[model samples]
Target chain A: MDTVCSINNLARCLVEGGFSPDLANLLTLLGGVVLVATIPLVTVIFLIWIERKVAARVQDRLGPNRVGPVGLLQTVADALKMLTKEDITPTGADKFIYNLAPVIAFATVILMWAVVPFTPLHIGADVGIGVLYFMAVASIGTVKIMVAGWSSNNKYALLGAFRTIAQLLSYEVPLVLSLLIPVMLAGTMSLQGITEAQGGMWYLFIAPVAAFLFYVANLAETGRAPFDLLEAESEIIAGYNIEYSGFKWGMFMASEFLHAFTAALFFAIIFMGGWWGPFVQEVPLLGALYLVGKTAIVYVFGLVLRATVPRVRIDQLMALNWKFLVPLAIANVLVIAFLIQVLKALGLMPVPGADIIAHLPMTVVMLLGNLVIIAVAMQVLRNQGREEKMAQEARMAARQQRVVKEVRTPAGAPVGD
Target chain B: MLEFNASTVAFVVMTLFILGGALGVVTTRNLIHATLYLILSLFGVAGYFVLLSAPFLAAVQVLVYIGAIAILIVFAVMLTRSMTRMSEILNGQWLLSAIVGAGLFLLLVIGVILPTWGNGGLLDATVSAPSQVVIDTVDLGKALVDRNGFVLPFEVASLLLTAAMIGAIVIARDDTE
Candidate 1:
């Protein structure tokens, strides 16, 4: 089963076919690096087109229908334009650092793909610390944004970068905390191992709240709507990348597009039983298709959210992360850990078996726990809403009374009245 | 004569990153630039951890140190507008600090070299062993939680972290009154 997509098997086959060992190994490594790099670059072209189409549809307008079938070549044309446009460097800006930031931003996301398991056989490294690698590489992005903002020598860019770092840092707590559920449940940090462990059932059913927290945190991490203060187009005029032009600006856009999709991909892999479908284990290429299919679905969901939701105030963003998501993530982790331990003790924990139906009992228990957590969260949200409503009504009533008193006092009214 | 092997090349490149970044950190007048150099140095340290077959440590190094701590340091640096463009790279304590730094470097070099020199053959034997032992992530996870392992220390560390977090929040909060 593991042999189907494995680069090791391919290398061995090459060796058996009379290729030198060193050459085979080198070729395999090179092929993997190339594949990982190309997948995102190629996909971003399509992703941008899809994002525009989706956003347009949601806004009740006709998207690109020119250049190719339904404007498919729009991104390609954009890429061409970006390539030909003038590259400008602002005077007094730190030129080297400013130039380096976009490359860093683009490269960091690609580095994350190095750990992504596309199919059973198609992993780059399959490192023991795969999940952590994703987090670590993603974190490097903050530095890149900082460099971009700081080196721009512009106040708005600096403010945008500041907001970005604050939002990213605040949300990272819950992001990491939510990731612990899968790590704990699978008992492995390896993404492939997590995927394989979910052979019986996806972690989404087992830990819905954790998955939800991860999704929200990821949205914030990617600076998507409700958390898009990083750019907040109307306010900061493109935030960190305002000074960048041409393909340098295009690279930042591409990285943002790639980052959003990457978050969805990670969500699919960790929670949605990545590459687990009919005959995927037998035919590994099918696994790749399944992964892509799931990632697209998740990606579209994120796009919908982006197009629909209003951006949150920076204070609200911070409060949501620190007060709500962080605590909820922590509580969810504790609940899951305790439940797992208790289930194991009672010998009620289901084995990772081929039969997906056998997972129902365990799933039901987890679902119940998730329900409790969700209920608590709803209660908190309802309370906050009620308090706001009451405060608004009180202010309205006080204003009305003041208006009536003013009318009663003839001196307070206009002399003509 | 140039004898090229993978590890040696990697080691040499990583050493350059470490040394160059450390040099940049100390000599750069711009605080933000210094912080970026510090990240580069930290990244090199993480690479060393990977070379040492401690990938978990390397990940932790990146996740905690580079990700959280370095970012926090940069955040702090950026917040103070005046600190970003420093007029001086060296202060009054430069000479004394240089001497102390040199002394510390010498001591560390000697400490590392003396033991390595004594155990060079043993180290080579271990390195050339057919099956090099590796501590996997599972073992680390288990060790952290097991009663006879590091459970006590681990819990205490968490408690300390929580306390520190609370203290930070309290100190940072604005006084409404």
Candidate 2:
């Protein structure tokens, strides 16, 4: 009876009720796919509304107050407007690819949900390589952006796509490397397996540096503020989707909102003991609630950061990813791997026990190691910042001296001026 | 007669994707369209991996080929001004290349595929394959890192990738001085 909530169990029931086996299986699979797809799509409307309200509050203004109570139905109204809006196809755009990009962009993010574990038993597929599946599907998103940019036949769109590729590809290194820590700790790539392993202790406590790296890289992955040079409106004129209009453009925006929220949910699932709370084991519905609640908290935190931080320069963005996060992520993985091996050799690893509290000693050791890593990373960043600042000052002084000399000279300009 | 097994249907769909996408890739005049078709073809290959029950390999195929390699190709396509609009996609050597490509195709079908799947061969009807053994992700992870497994090869691969990355950066860097 407790297993009735599972898709497999429902399939069995359908078979017993005299449906053909093939039909039953197909129906069950389709049902699961529909459920997984609907989750992100349905939530995206609310996500946009919440984001606007949050941004408005951050900027000291009343957001959408006309649609419904507290402007809850604003997204609904916006959707209607989007549907009725005239779809524009730019004059030199590749007809097929220009139309395909939005669908692919939206579909790829939804594909990621196929592996996300909403509860202990309510996952879509529970594929063995769930983490890699997420990364792979997310990578297809880069292709979608490229197609959008190229098909638009606009220079700004192409530039935006170039930035998207560089940023997404560069950040993927740290994202995948940091992801390795959780996979190593759990000894499984399955998202469900990772979450279940966290039954004892959250990976966030054990690998805080890895978690931070994952968060930063994924923030860039979503092209949010401080890492959002891809769609920096002042610079690239809304990036790859500049020429899109109507529902096609809406699809791109919805995918972005969905991707941001999905990153938060993934962070919760990987590092924050997703769907793990009191009585969740007995009541699976409660697990779903806990997962959503934790995801919302993380999502709100991301929103606040987006509202507060200014966008980074393109060069700075690339340097921050390639030079800083990549090395730090690699070093963090190596140290954590070594620490795990050492702990196992010393017979200090916590024995598998039913009580979640039994894993305290192991958690503490990993937490202390993570603290050391974070401290070292901070020291490195501080030194790098100081050096950069000093160099900038020196350059400015030299330029000022050159200006003074040029002004003092009778000639208006020097040879190299 | 139509056979309606799940795997059979999946195989047909994936085959259509692979062939259609391959056709699209070669026939398209636009470089960007060709790249998009290339992605479709790579995706079809990934789908084939999934059908073969190699989910990890499928993910890697998508991640590397479509995600990284295909995108890099598109990036290169967009950078060059004259390459994007190549009206003459084929050159004077088209006939010779076509002949060679057809010969290679025939060689692959005759020498590699046919003998392996012929009657009483490795993939014949009499040869009942062994029962499926579900290999967990943990085993895959261990095999990559274990001393007797693929640790050395994996490390070497990583080293090679790092070297290639460094080489690429050095080649791409513009030193005006």
Candidate 3:
């Protein structure tokens, strides 16, 4: 056990202790996986509690103070309650798929943890295609929603699934486009590489528009407000998981909370420089603390937004994605790519592995490029808003004229006819 | 006889996924179930790409095929009435369709196996082992845009996709508006 400091050490120790090499390697790999997987499972309990407290605070209420000191054990109690509750299966529901959906929903989120770089030294797998792997796993989450909705054998569930698919599939375009920025800047799709590359300066400074786009798209991706049309309680009940109950429903809820946190974690890693802070290189464990701190900030922001913002209508949601985010993301990518090339040609770009000071010139140029795009986009939005307001006023005026005419002609008379 | 190695075990598992999923797709009475099965099959192919050491390709396969294509198919199935379940598995042209399917399968088998057989049967191809060949994703990205590489074909493919997207929008647009 003393040799279990790292997976490699553990495997080596086992091999030296007379265990077969293959068996030792397999055991260590399994142990590493279980260790990584448990972090989310354990953290999600605290996250749910934190979310409730934040929401309660924003809405002027105390949240679960009775469960334990500061309501620390509230999520545990809720989990117990959920477990003891009766599980119901609707008549005519596809039982296999209904059972499978929650599992997939929970598993998909956990699978994403495989690629998350917690520290410079700690990662689950550090796969070469980490970013794309995250995208792929996130996409599978849609299928889980679809399965849940379809298997529930309810109209509301089906409608919720449809909305979920539309919202998820639409938001994914901008999400992927925004993700490319970090990949391009780092010249690697692996999350660890991206984090390392951001050591000089976080991509948030270099490509603020892309960061903004990623944040917005991530909010939509996680089905959080104001883009949370999928489960709009007033309209679709509980959405895809409407038919689920007991621990099954708990699984869906747990996954949703965890997914939101994971998105924040990825956002922090991609844009805020994951595991990179003063003295972090000397102490790898401190890097984990930095990652957690960054994730917490982003997560709290998401919770506050969710608490404050009203959910957008389905049409507005679609319009925002296709009309605004998608186009803006595309333009941002193109501009950034062009700027990188120009900087390189002019010898202004920082050499690979340069320090923060060396990155200043290139970062400044890219930041200005992003600011210009943002300014232009704001102007376009302002013009569009004014035009829409004028159209509304004209329509109101015409309606007023018609009403006045009707009153002058006497009500119910055939004067217009 | 196949070697009892990790790769062999993984390959066997992937083969099961692909074949089982394919069988389930055709045999299922429900359209939604069939689509799900198709996704499973596609996912197995992605697994094969991973096994072949092309993690980038594997990820793209899952993203594009299982994520986008299968979801679109599911949406389409849900949109059409009475498409989820069918009472009859066979249509009037089942016999003709079966013959076509069989022919296509045979052609695929011959095309895949013939070239490999000339060397040392299907199992002993000249392709290097996955562990022996390491291709960095950065190299893959460069090759896509490199002047002497896939730049022309890549641009052309993207252009074709753009054209197709515009055509779709045009067809779906409300002419009265």
Give the candidate number with the greatest DockQ. 2
- lDDT score at residue A413, model 2, on the 0-100 scale: 48
Chain A structural similarity (TM-score) per candidate? Answer: 0.94, 0.94, 0.97
Please, what are the lDDT tens digits per residue for candidate 3 over residues A188-277?
888999999998899999999999999999999999999888789999888989999999999999999999999999999999999999
Model 3 chain A: lowest-lDDT 10 consecutive positions: A1-10
Which residue ranges in model 3 land beyond 4 Å of their true spot?
A: A1-8, A411-417, B118-124, B127-134, B170-177
Which ten contiguous residues of candidate 2 chain A have the minimum total lDDT? A1-10
Task: List residue ranges in candidate 2 displaced over 4 A.
Answer: A1-9, A352-354, A399-417, B1-3, B122-137, B170-177
Q: DockQ of every model listed?
A: 0.71, 0.89, 0.84
lDDT of 2 by residue, A64-164 (tens): 98999999999999999999999999899989889999999999988888888888888988988889999999998998888898889899998898888
**By TM-score, is 1 or 3 better?**
3
Candidate 2: give the clashing pairs. none
Chain A (candidate 2) TM-score to true chain A: 0.94
Where does model 1 exceed 4 Å of error? A1-20, A402-417, B1-4, B119-134, B170-177
Ranking of predictions according to TM-score: 3, 2, 1
Error of 2 at A249 (Å): 1.1
